[model samples]
Target: MEKKKISIDKSACIGCGCCAGTYPEDIAIGADGLAESVTGVAEEDVASVCPVGAISVEE
Candidate 1:
């Protein structure tokens, strides 16, 4: 399997919870109130759901 890197630009995150709501297994809201890739579950869909374009994936 190909390894992927998930990056979250907290600055751009609107804290909308869309990522966490859509993929609770992959992402979550952190103490700073930003979306974080907690589990590194490798779900690219999370990036698509981000309203502020905060998530990026590199494969």
Candidate 2:
């Protein structure tokens, strides 16, 4: 299976903590108050909790 890459559209991010809570190991709240990935973590749980749809998984 192809490795999925996670992407966050900062402009579309509403500063929600859902992604951060869901994927603490990879997702975090950046200084800009947006959801950011520490690395290219592919987590379906994080994407599912994103309300503004700022998270995307590329495979």
Candidate 3:
């Protein structure tokens, strides 16, 4: 089985938190106000909802 992972590009993130709102279980805004992956498989959803294209997935 593959382990799913998600990451955010801090530089590209606009801190919209849309990814967080879309997938609260897996994404959230860090102290710096950047989108962060908390847990579970959120890569695909984050990448799709992020308007700035700041999210990426590692399988």
After superposition, candidate 1 runs with Cα above 4 Å error: 1-3
Error of 2 at 44 (Å): 2.8
Clashing pairs in 1: none
lDDT of 2 at 32: 91
Candidate that would win on TM-score: 2
Displacement of residue 27 (Cα, Å) in model 3 is: 0.6
Better of 2 and 3 by TM-score: 2
| RMSD per model, one decimal | 2.4, 2.3, 2.9
* Model 2 / residue 51 / CA error / Å: 0.5
lDDT of 3 by residue, 1-59 (tens): 23357778889999998989978878889999897777846745457788988888775
lDDT of each: 0.79, 0.81, 0.78
lDDT of 3: 0.78
Model 1, position 43, has a per-residue lDDT of 66
Segments in model 3 whose C-alpha atoms lie over 4 Å from true places: 1-3
For candidate 1, write residues 3-38 as lDDT tens digits: 256888988998999988887877889998888887
Q: Which residue pairs overlap in candidate 2's backbone?
A: none
- Candidate 3 versus the native: TM-score? 0.78
